[model samples]
Target: MQDQPLNAADFDAIESTLLKYGDDHSVLNPSELDGYFTALVSSPEQVDIAEWFPGIWGGQNPAWETPDEAKQFIELSVRHINTLARQLAEDSAAFAPRFEQTEHLGHDVTLAEEWCFGYLRGVAVANWTPLPAIQATLLQAISDCAEQDNFELPQDLDVVAHQQRVAAIAPAVRALHDYWLSQR
Candidate 1:
């Protein structure tokens, strides 16, 4: 079966539909959502863009910067990342392309949710900033993952195999993660 090609337009349609339904169960505020979308549009990356579609990880980029700047970037990045993740959890259809297997759907979602949250928190706390909202977004993403009790298969989607793909980018995320951890 051909994988579903879910792009920005698909997500935008999903968002519009959700808004028309008058649901506010999103993990982020309006501005944060905007920030996430803006980041994607301005500079498309793999890890983040993959977030809009299910079962696909747009492998996270490693960050590099001075101590103070790193802290600031972490806070903002977490806020934006969690916001997009939250939107995914809220509207699964928009992301159904990623979850192609029923048996491990829940597990995958949970992993993704936790990974995003843990990575966000790990980076944020590592930086030691007073960005409470960023922390809240991370917590919220975790909560959303916890609330899911079932799994579904992603239809016609592209799967990002973490192992096969990390070859080129592991150093960056690790360096960023380690740098933040070192501050503690």
Candidate 2:
């Protein structure tokens, strides 16, 4: 699916069951997606990229509450997408392309919806596609793999290749990226 703005309703539905802390937008800022990679590279050095969130056990108490839950949300989204990737790689032949970007890969809306709004919501409220662009890419790639019965994601692949796979899966990634930048 192409990148689109998630209105208040989408956010409301996601945060509906979760306990409200402070301003939900601050806790679930879309800008985190851009800052995440920078934070990963600048470890040990302090940055403004931080937020309060729940505890390790999924508890969101008063004292231990994290200021931002972006990291948790990204991790959850990544795990969901990676699982699909591994599955596609394991059975490469059974997959097929879903997006027109690549020969076989195509967009996978179900994977995107499930991971973005479903699994990610389990931990903290997320702003939908604003966070899961990377995950969405992976899910699309997995969908492509599914089209072919002999498709398999390479095990020894590096991060760049993984990114290429994601890019190929979703042409909308650029739109998503631009939307993310607009959110900043």
Candidate 3:
């Protein structure tokens, strides 16, 4: 397993591959993929790759042009999964969701909607259920961000509120990881 962390170039390659083969499917981008993998790793119950891999391409596997292309995708994804698992286990603070950077009201802001949505997707795939009240609340923080549609902020949500929810996601995820770790 190529456990070296994926650099920018690797992410670009993954993004390019998704765009090239995604067609009309709702394929996850690099940032979304990271969150998805994080949730899968943090899941209390182990999820098999055979079950979750298809979810990346929106319930179907992409048809790569060559065997090597498929191989590279699998390698990168497995490496990322392992990296997240290791980070969450060794140093939960080191685990950060890959959020997209953008400008909001003339200030630089990081948006986590896509990443949060991907995480929720993983949770659904893992069939996570019956959580204790505290852990449920932690997961709800990520859910708050996930509920927003792309580029469509809720009318009732001011910038401050939105930023607060986004800020809470990382800590909530870390706590969730810790909760599951303690269970094991």
* The candidate that achieves the highest TM-score relative to the unseen native structure: 3
TM-score of structure candidate 3: 0.92
lDDT of candidate 3 vs native? 0.83
lDDT of 1 by residue, 80-170 (tens): 4554444443442332111112234233321233233333333332233442474444434433532433233355323344222222122
TM-score of each: 0.22, 0.21, 0.92
What lDDT tens digits, residue by residue, belong to model 2 across residues 1-184? 1123234553343243233442343223222221222112112221121321332113343332453454444344344233333333354343322221222244222212211222233213232332466645643453453343223333443435444643453333333334433454
How many residue pairs clash in all the candidates, one count each?
Answer: 13, 31, 0
lDDT of 2 at 135: 44
Prediction 2 TM-score vs. true: 0.21
Off by over 4 Å in 2: 1-52, 55-124, 129-174
> Which regions of candidate 1 fall more than 4 Å away from where they truly are?
1-110, 127-153, 160-170, 178-184
lDDT of 1 at 170: 23
Q: What tens digits encode model 3's per-residue C-alpha lDDT throughout 1-184? A: 4778888988998898877776454555888888898899989888999988888888888777899999998888888898999999998888889999876656566789889888988888888877999899999888887777748544454777667778899999998888887776
